[model samples]
Target: MSSAEGNLTWEPATRHTELLAGPVARAIAATPSARVAPIDAELADTAAFCAAYDVAMESSANCVVVAGKRGGEVRYAAVLVLASMRADINGAVRRHLDVRKISFAPMDQAVELTGMEFGGITPIGLPADWPVLVDEAVVAAGDVVIGSGIRGSKVLVPASELATLATAEVLPLSL
Candidate 1:
C-alpha cells in the first residue's frame, strides 16, 4: 500500500501497536509523519532492507547502542546515523558522552535492555537516560527509514521529528 504522497508502501506506524510497543508505539502515534511497513524478517538488515524496499541507502538511518564506563559507572547511548557513514564512537560520541572510551553494546545487553531485536533497534523507544545522538546528516535527510523495534517491519519518519525527541541531540556523529 504505497502512500500517495511519497509513493511509499508505508502504513501508519501507530497502526501496528502490537509489533511496536512502549515508547516506539507512543512516538509513532505522536509524530504526524511517522509510517511503518511490514517486511520479511530476514530483510531487516540495512542492505537487504534497502534493496528489497527500493529505499536509498543514504536515507536509511541506523540506531546503534554503545556502552562504556566512567569512574566505575556504566554509561549507555543510542546513536543515529545514516547507513552511508559509521558512527564516530571514538571521537564524537565519546566526547559527547564525556566518557574516555566507548564501543558497540554487546548484542545480548542491547537486546535485553531495549527489548528489541539486534537488527531492529531504533531511537524511538530507547531508555530515557540514554542520549539519542543523531548525526547532522540524518537530521537533514528529510524523511528516512528506521528500525521498528522488530525485524519484521520498519518505520518511516521525518528527520525533524526525530530531533524533537526528548533525548535527541543533533551533532556530527558520523565519520
Candidate 2:
C-alpha cells in the first residue's frame, strides 16, 4: 500500500462485495490487485475523506460523470482526475467527446444510471458503452484511492491498472 493510504485496514475487494455497489463488486472481482477499506459514510467526499483519514489529496482520484450533447443526441462518459485537479469539462473533455456542449451529469441521473451512491461513483463499473477517460497524471500516480461505488468504503488500486480497463482512454483530461 502507498504511504499516503490512510489508517483504514485494506482487504481484498472481491471478498467484501457488501461494501460495494452491485456493478462495482462484479467489476472489481476481475481486478486482483484491488483493495477495499471501510470508512464513515459522512466523509465519503474527496476532501473530507482525505482529511479525516490522513490521506493525501494527490493520492486520491475522483470519477465524475458527464453528459455531452450534439445534434439532439446525448452521450455519457466517466472522467477520472486526481483530487488535486479538476476535469477540463468544457475544453479537453468536450473536444474528446466530439460534442457541442458538455457538462457534469445531474446527480440523480448519474446515480441512477451508474447504480452507485451520489457521492461515491467510480469509473470501474460504468455502462459498457460509456468511455472511461482517465487523466494521464492519474495513471502515473501509482497506487491511488477511489470511490468503491458506495459512500461507506473506498477502493485502492494501482493507477496503471485503471488505464487498462476495456473502455478506458488515457488523456490529458485535467485542468
Candidate 3:
C-alpha cells in the first residue's frame, strides 16, 4: 500500500507481465468483448512488434516524458502518444504547460523516478504525485496498450480506466 494504499504492499508476481497482470489485466478481463494477448519479448521495434502480433499502431499508446521549468518550478510532464503519431512537445505541449525551457528528461532520471527501465515507462506504476497527461486521442478511442513497467510486458486498458488507475488528467496531448 505504501502511502497510497496505507502501507500495503501487494504480493507482486515474479513475471514482468504479472506485476500489471493482476490489476490492469483484470480490468480488461472484466470486458469479455475485448481480446487480451502478449507478443514475444524478443520483438522490440514498434512496427515489427505490432505487425508480428497483429496489434494496431493507434491502439498503442507511447508514454513519453519531458523535463523543464514552468515559471519558478522545475517539473516533468508525461505524455501519451500514439505509436503512429509524433509528440509535438515543443509546440502544443510546451505552450500548454507554459514551460519556459523544456527537454526530454535524461534516461537516468526517467529510470530513477519510475523505477522502470527505459523504453518501459508506462503511466501505470508511476509516482502518485506525477501528472499523467492523457492524450486526447487515447481518451477518444477509449482504450490503449502501453508498456507495463517492464520491457517485455504491456497492458491493454480503456482510456477512462487508465485515467482512474493513474489519477491522470485526460487532456490535449499534443499538436
Candidate 4:
C-alpha cells in the first residue's frame, strides 16, 4: 500500500532498501509501521526537506548525536526532538548522562560511529549501546517524518513507536 503525504509518495521502507543505509534498512525491515519516501538529496536537511515537501515543521523530527565525557570515559547518545524545538543538551541531557561536559558530537565522529551520513542519521539504527533519548513532545506528536539514514529519502513512523526502541527513553529532553 502507498499514499501521499505533503508532496511525497510513501511506501513500505522494506521495499526500498537501496534508499536506506544498511543498518537502517535492516531496522525498517523489522519495523512494520515504518514507511519510506524518496526526495531530492539536496533537500535532505530538515528545513529544506520540510519546505520543499510542504510538510509541517511540527510533523518532522531530527536526530542529533551527542557526546558526554566524564573523566576518561565518553558516552554517546542519539537525541530526538521535533524540528520546531531544540534539545536541552546543556542542562537535562548533561545531567541525565551524568557527565562533566556534553556537546553535539563532531560530524565526522557521528558519521563514523553511526555508519550513517552526517545529515541523515536516524535513531533507529544507532549502536546498540547508545541511548536513544527521545523528547516527550516528539513521542506525543503522532506520526512524524525523520531521516532514513541516507540523504535521498525519509522515513515516516508513529512517534510512539520510537519510544519503544530498546534503547529509547522518553523524557523532557527539549527546550
* Best model per TM-score: 2
**Model 4 Cα lDDT, one tens digit per residue, 56-149:** 8998999999999999899999999999999999999999999999999999999999999988999888999999999999988888898999
Tens-place lDDT per residue, model 2, 1-175, is 4655778899889898888999998898556788999999999998999999988899999999999999999999999999999889999999999999989999999999999999899988889999999999999888899999999999999988899998999999888
Report each candidate's C-alpha RMSD, comma-separated, in the order given: 2.5, 0.9, 8.9, 2.0
Best by lDDT: 2
Which TM-score value belongs to model 1?
0.92
lDDT of 3 at 46: 60
Runs with alpha carbons beyond 4 Å of true place in candidate 4? 1-4
Better of 3 and 4 by lDDT: 4
Clashes of each: 0, 0, 2, 0
Q: Estimate the lDDT of model 3.
A: 0.63
Candidate 1, residue 72: lDDT: 78
The collision pairs in model 4 are none
- Per-residue lDDT tens digits for candidate 3, residues 27-118, read 33333223233445676456666676566787777888787697679777788878878877887777767888888899999888777767
| Backbone clashes in model 3, listed as residue pairs | 1-8, 1-9
Decide which is better by lDDT, 2 or 4.
2
Of the two candidates 2 and 4, the one with more favorable TM-score, higher being better, is 2
TM-scores, all candidates, are: 0.92, 0.98, 0.74, 0.96
lDDT of 3 at 25: 40
As for model 1, its CA RMSD to the true structure in angstroms is: 2.5
